[model samples]
Target: MKVEDFDMFCTLLRQRSGLVLTSDKAYLLESRLMPVARKWTLKSLDELAVAVRSKRDEALLRDITEAMTTNESSFFRDQKPFDQFKQVVLPHLLANRAAKKQIRVWSAACSSGQEAYSLAMLLQEEGARLAGWRIEILGTDLSSEMVNKARAGLYTQFEVQRGLPITHLVKYFKQMGDKWQLNDDIRGKVQYREYNLLSDLTPLGQFDVIFCRNVLIYFDQPTKSKVLEAMAKLLPPDGILYLGGAETVLGITEKFKPMEGQRGLYTLAAK
Candidate 1:
């Protein structure tokens, strides 16, 4: 792509999604956007850029934005966060909210629903303990296609294999021809929606816990701080937030502090 075209494309992405694409990552534009270009009948990224620059093609622009957003996810990804949830977070929240007997979890930027489904499986395993409790798992992402997939609860053989134990797989999934479909019981526990982190989050309601993992890595520091602050507003004083291994609250916002001895876990800061 031409230098001017590349710069305009980067600007468009940043304006729409808060993603920062420096020159070093320009190759990503060429690689990830080729399919988008072809879909729109553009011969090359340069043509795509020209189309974006020359016209207000909302549909085309939306596709480009969604294409650029990272969607990498797996069941029980990164192990430790789920471990912390099962071992520490769940127990603590259970005891703390025993009177209410309700808990809500938001899996922010929940790409394709793996993390939310993982949580549902864990809760399903503890079904006896939560017999009378009200549980809601909200999984939201920027991609409607991913939201639909997550809602369908269908996965390819390779998708189910990643970080999914054979025992749970056999217990919870039934093979449908080739792809594996999660049981209705587990799939029913979670809700999926298309949401932008940069948009208003208050409409989603308050939550006891949230998993905003890995997504802020794509945003600039200012955007990171802004998004974090918005999330902090949705939490109660004792609510927990789980970020990716590489993300931290240290330099971002003062609304939260690391939960001692818990990896990727944070709680609202004390008054």
Candidate 2:
């Protein structure tokens, strides 16, 4: 790829989706975008970049962004986060929010709905305690393809095998030829939306807990702070934020502090 073409794509990805496409990973970008290039009838990535830069086709730009955005996810990924949610966060919310009996969870950058559905499964396990309460789980991702797949609530055998237990799979999913589709009860508990984290989040309303795992590692520091602080606005003092095990709010923002003894758990800092 030409130097200018590489620079243009890097800038485009950062501006459009806050993805920092470093030069070292240019080959990865080229590989991922080759199919998109073919889809648009372009001969090579250079042609695709020139067309995107010169023509500014919004649809093509969106396709490029989606192609580059990583959608890696698995059910109940990182067992600790889910365990903390069940043992710590849920109890806190259950005890504190009795009067209103309402809770809302957001799975930001929710790739294929596994994280949100895992939470739904946990909620189902607490069926008796939460019977009369209203709980809502919303999963959002920038990629429309992923949002649609998440809505379908279907997973291949390989996908189900990862981070998912035999008991839960048997209880919650029905085998369809080669894939497993989650039961309507669990699937219905969560809703999926195609959304960008770079935009204003106020319209999404408040969330009592947010699971924004594994996505921020792609962002630059400023972009990380931008996204984290923006999320801070949507959470109450008692609300908890769950980031990927490698991600943190330290030196990023004062909006949240690490929850004691919880590796990825964060709570709003005191005013």
TM-score of each: 0.97, 0.98
lDDT of each: 0.92, 0.93
**Per-residue lDDT of 126-159 in model 2, one digit per residue for the tens?**
9998979999999999999999999999999999
Q: Per-residue lDDT for 94 in model 2? A: 93
- The segments of candidate 2 whose C-alpha lies over 4 angstroms from its true place after superposition are none
Backbone clash count for every predicted candidate, in the order shown: 0, 0
lDDT of 1 by residue, 58-153 (tens): 999899999998889999998889888889998998899999999999999898899999999999888898889999999999888889999999
Tell me, by lDDT, which candidate is best: 2
Q: What global local distance difference test value does model 1 have? A: 0.92
lDDT of 2 at 230: 95
Worst 10 residues of 1 by lDDT: 47-56
RMSD of each: 1.0, 0.8
